[model samples]
Target: MRSDTAALTTITLPEIRLRVRDAHKLRGYFGELFREHSPLLHNHYEDGTFRQQYPLVQYKVLDGTPTLVGLGEGAALLVELFLRIRELDIDGRHYPVQAKHIEHRTEAIGPVAGLRRYRFETLWMPLNQDNHRQYQTQSAAEQQAQLTRILTNNMLALLKAVGAYASDMPLLLVHLLPGEPVVTQFKNQSMLGFMGEFVANIALPDGVGLGKSVARGFGAVRRVD
Candidate 1:
């Protein structure tokens, strides 16, 4: 007879996700949540380094329910914060999300080569000194070039910070998927940041986020397949 564990495969989740009821009502600054329950993390990681090293602990309202996600190091923080805080109140409603009760799926890592195309629901590529002059009149090709450079830098940084020594720079390709990109609407302005599809030449594990403001609900992406 085959051992029960013989075929078991380990799924290295690129991100850890948790669910909360009445997720749509969750509001207020993400910094507040960390400061209140995970103060040390707030002071050391969340303040700045986190945005560079890992995606911040973030929540999103999907299907009318709130979902909490941790990326890379943020995963550990998510688990700890939920356990310590037990329940939290954001905006005005209460969320009884506990680490024990938090839900997750047993997953197995898939081929890194298979994960190429990705869809971004929100992507905010910030202005940099290098490209500040091209902000207004940049052509589509130029914009793509800038994005590729920025993305390459961020990924390399993540690998270095995590001490993943074999990161010889995975192949990456950027392009826009044919369709209307999502636009962010504000009371006074309408901004269309980076939102589209990316086809990487290498395996980018599922749940890898890119660009800027990923912690605050921008630049969240998943493998298209």
Candidate 2:
């Protein structure tokens, strides 16, 4: 049983309303605003190279409000820039910010004793190009099993990103609730995304995004229990 702690910071623009589809635009706005910290903000190098690691800072539009979540070092960076964010410029339109709220927490990243239920507040994309093709050919049960395995892997990746490597890999099971997946557009291409709940024997911080395109806020989860 190994556990590690990381700083988590969430900044929400409560008074500002933005379309969920403009999450990437919010990322772009902040990334350019803080170019010196572009790597931490957008996971891009100054030379325009992509950082091949988990994004510590993620942008999201949850419930029609622009939100920023940062973990570990990124948390500190977000705190540093929180006071500087006064407005948003999206698609040549200006939206002035009025009231903002920020929360900080020290979250545990490790295995848990009991299964915990989590709901995907945002769409969860568990398939890539290769798996997308294979996922369509599988039976319903097989698809669920495949998604379970991928989710377990996703948990491991998140733990590794926070430097919390479990000495003994915990038993991870993702029992997806009965629901139909939604087809969403990502990068102009249609993708299958799931918006439901699952039970896992691990604890994750709220506002943390998982799966692909997490930096753009695709897979945000919150514990229901």
Candidate 3:
């Protein structure tokens, strides 16, 4: 196992009541406002090409409040811009920011002795276009197995992006707690999303996102146990 440390910072506009669906708008607003800072803010290059890297700064709406999470270098960027975020201008509507809460932490990323349970505070999108068709044909048990594999792969990618890579890491288990997967819209296309808790022998910090469209707050998880 490779020992790695990640710096994480979370900023929440506690007084703002933004709908979860408008998270992309938040991304758009900040991406444009701070376009000169770095491409990680919006995951786009100056020439309009997509940066094929893990998104370090992610936008999310947790519990009806606008939340922004930054990891690694992204954490530093958020800290630098923390004080300047005074309000949000979404579609010409001015929403004044009343109060904000920020939390910063450095977490170790590696295998843990025991599994940690985490709940999906936001929807977890596990399938992409190619796999979506296959997922539709699988049995319930097979579907669960496939999703577990995808979740594990997602974790590996996240760890690698954060400078930790463990080829012999312990198995990760995803238990879909008693509910049917919900269909949601992502980038104007319908997609399936899961809402449940997962257990993994990895030390993932709270507010880290997983799976697809995470930059838009698709798979936000918080430690529940």
Name model 3 segments beyond 4 Å from true. 1-3, 168-178
lDDT of each: 0.46, 0.87, 0.86
- TM-scores of all candidate predictions against the true structure: 0.61, 0.95, 0.93
Q: How well does model 1 score by local distance difference test?
A: 0.46
Among all candidates shown, the one with the greatest lDDT: 2
Q: Which pairs clash (backbone N, Cα, C closer than 3 Å) in model 3?
A: none
Which stretches in model 2 have alpha-carbon errors above 4 Å?
none
1-225 per-residue lDDT for model 2 (tens digits): 555788999999998888887888999999888988648897889788998888999999999989999998889899989899999999999988888899988998778777889999988888888999999999999988888888888888888888876667766656777268789887788889988888887889988988998988888999998
- What's the lDDT for residue 6 in model 1? 8
Clashes of each: 3, 0, 0
Better of 1 and 2 by TM-score: 2
Candidate 1 lDDT by residue in tens digits, 1-225: 110100111112122232322222232434555565553233244454532345435545432344555544555566655545445566565656433335333222222444367766445444444464574478767766766777666555444433342534434444445244335542234554666676654434334445554444455566776
